[model samples]
Target: MNAEVRVNAVFSDHMVLQREATIPVWGTGLDGMVVKLQFHGKQTEAVVANGCWRADLPAEKAGGPYELIIEAGNQLIVFRDVLIGDVWLAGGQSNMQWSLAQTDHAQAEIVDSHIPDFRFYDVPRVSYEDGIVHSPSWKVCTPEHAGAFSAVAYYFAKGIITELGIPIGIIGCNWGGTSIACWVSEQVLTHDDDLRIYADEYNEQIENFDWDVFAAKEAHYKEQIAEYDRRFAAGLREKELGDFPAAPMNPHYFLRPFGLYSTMLLTVVPFALKGVLFYQGESDAHRPLIYDKLLTAMISHWRTIWHHSMLPFLFVQLPAFGNGGNANGKEWPLLRESQLIVTEQVPYTGMVVALDCGDLEDIHPTNKKPVGERLALLALERVYEQPVESSGPVYKDYLIDHNKIILHFDHTGNGLEARGNQLIGFEIADETNEYVSAQAVIEGATVEVWSDQIVNPLAVRYGWANYTEANLVNSFGLPAGPFRTKREERQ
Candidate 1:
């Protein structure tokens, strides 16, 4: 084995590389072989280090179906079907992490998709670090394999390939049922005073907690929750909302705040990507006030670490989950506002509305195409400089006309069109907490709203419940996400 040479990013036949930038090509080699990379008539060289060699190839403009030959002395290896194009990192929670196989039309989608130009690089679905694994192999797009990948990511890649007509690579690194905090770095957490307080405490707790006892307690809680679910399903309200309360609804992924963020920051955020696509907020809904700060911190922290100022990040507000319960929808509203605040605080960030894309009964919506597609649209318009209309009727401005409220919008590209029928789930409330059906008319750039009962309307809220018939879409046919804007901020 003295004269043998080995390579990684080697097993794959067709490799995708991002063009117009210096791509780091690194691997192990003989002690003094002088490893060289040859592609598209250009050759780059590097010296071996501890039996390894790495070099930054001069940036090449996108265009190619080329061959790459890596040589270490006389030992040579050739990687075929190399293409240079756009690479995107698709991340976030279950909505973003949902595989094509789980969506409504999985079978049909997977069967029809066979574009070979699109490739996927799945970072092992791990939240913790095993250190940096040097680049995963890119998988070619095929029906049998596409279904196993993230539905949102697959579709997004497909869209990009269809439009750009170039090789596209998607990096899917998302963990389901995880929160924003879990994806942050411990170093950053330690740096932030607002976060360090809890991080220190969590560290102490982890060190002191009796693992056996904690595990048993968690198991007990799960068992108890299961019993409550059985009771609730049997038409029993005895312990439905009363017994469970809020804390026990879901198991805490990070029993303490700042724990998750710190861990992911170091382990997950190393890859160089154009931007981020976020889909979360269901877990942090309860602490809406704090969420604004938390979200702002995460965005800032990510940009700072990546050293990319003004990175484009698109997020989705929480979709309606849990079978149409009596949830006042307070959390959802607060979280939406938090999302809005993030955009206002962080530059180049956008959001997608999913009010009409939720399951009335189940929390995880079966359709993920819209979520990912809308994200790509934002990228197309803002990132890729492609012409595309990618937003619904957004709450723009509000005018107080005596006791009436006139709500305006910005991106109603083709004007607002309520899906399938009437404008539902809109309520106008006065100073007193009393509310009633509000009359609304979509005209020009505004939706004039009012209710006779509240002639001096102080607030206007749309779809502020777990289950409200709210399907207001713009001419572009995207549903308006759930939101509430009052004359004064109540949340």
Candidate 2:
């Protein structure tokens, strides 16, 4: 007799199955035992193939709290407290991983999580040797369970729950201090020459480091322990900061990019989900130019592996943070532009504009409900198709007329309105290419721009800064995205 029954541990009570799509239910059983799955008025059955049986259950329309019963051999696994609705994968670094406990209304939110149906299944972080991952099942959302879930995912789901009234399942797979490259596949990194150079250099660093030599260095210091201890205690606060290069060059800091992705994403994460909600880029803010290619590769790699085209892949745009120069603050204008480029190139992709919600001092913004809520708004309208539009006003195009530059925007449902009474950050340029403060006034549905200094304006920009208090908003109450027209304003 062989022990034969395994369901990915992530599937548990209160899991939300995808509505209106082929649902795959699999587990191990007797070599040829017939597995029966009965859910939502459909009974599907399949024979155990190589001791693993998978039943493709017919699609169910968006609605449930229904039961899912699986029977095989002498074992019967019954999943209670289930629901049918939208499920999305929320992934990224600390921002995406930030817990509800860290948010503003955590106490109230956690207590309220005991609500009937919303669910989130968290997968443990584990790295692997291959590109394919098989992770465990999920945990339903409850007050006790909600304490540890991601705040970004939770708020996003809350917005969906209030609007859709259907159970929402969030698959959270995030890690703090993670890089975009680490989520990309090895093949993509190897294929691109620019990225390959970084990979080769990284592997070389790991290859050349001698751990024995490192140990010897530590051992050598052990002999002079008394002196070392005196120096460490007396006035060596600098050493406490940690040294990057111990033996002329650091070993751990130089590991290959995506080396961890191959190790973790493939080994620990499961591939089935409606789509991905990604928020990363703080690590690569310095290389804002390369950030585009890095993210594009990461998204493309995952989509190829999952075999889903036009998967509703959404991401949070980089929010404002740092005091001034760190992460190339002013340079971020270009990076945000690069993100727009990816959205332009890729279909079924949307960006959650967080430029307005950033806190200047702290890198991690505390007001997270809005961030999660905004992303959910996009998902609901675009992915769930709820009865509402989901976006701040977006810049569409512009017109140059004499000393005035007329701006046009998209999805200005009912028209544009400033959050405050006045517009604060619009800039216009003269033939000299010099930018001067431009005045903005709503002319019916478009914004008319002009500046005293820019008597012959050629281009214009709005709220395009590392820190700003732009009041531009659409009738939807969503702010307008930072934007600029590309003609040589002064030249």
The TM-score values for the models, in the order shown, are: 0.83, 0.81
lDDT of each: 0.71, 0.73
- Candidate 1 on 172-280: residue-level lDDT in tens? 7566666566666666567866656546755665665565777777788888788778777887753243456223221244334444454433333434456777787
Candidate 2 C-alpha lDDT tens digits along 152-248: 9988888888887877788877777667766776678789975675567656766767878767776655556655566666755333422222232
Task: Tell me the spans in candidate 1 whose CA falls farther than 4 Å from its real position.
Answer: 1-13, 27-35, 47-54, 71-78, 127-136, 193-201, 211-271, 323-326, 433-436, 487-491
Q: Residue 436 of model 2: what lDDT?
A: 77
Model 2: how far is 151 from its true place, Å?
1.4
Q: How close is candidate 1 to the true structure, as a TM-score?
A: 0.83
Per candidate, the number of residue pairs that clash is: 13, 16
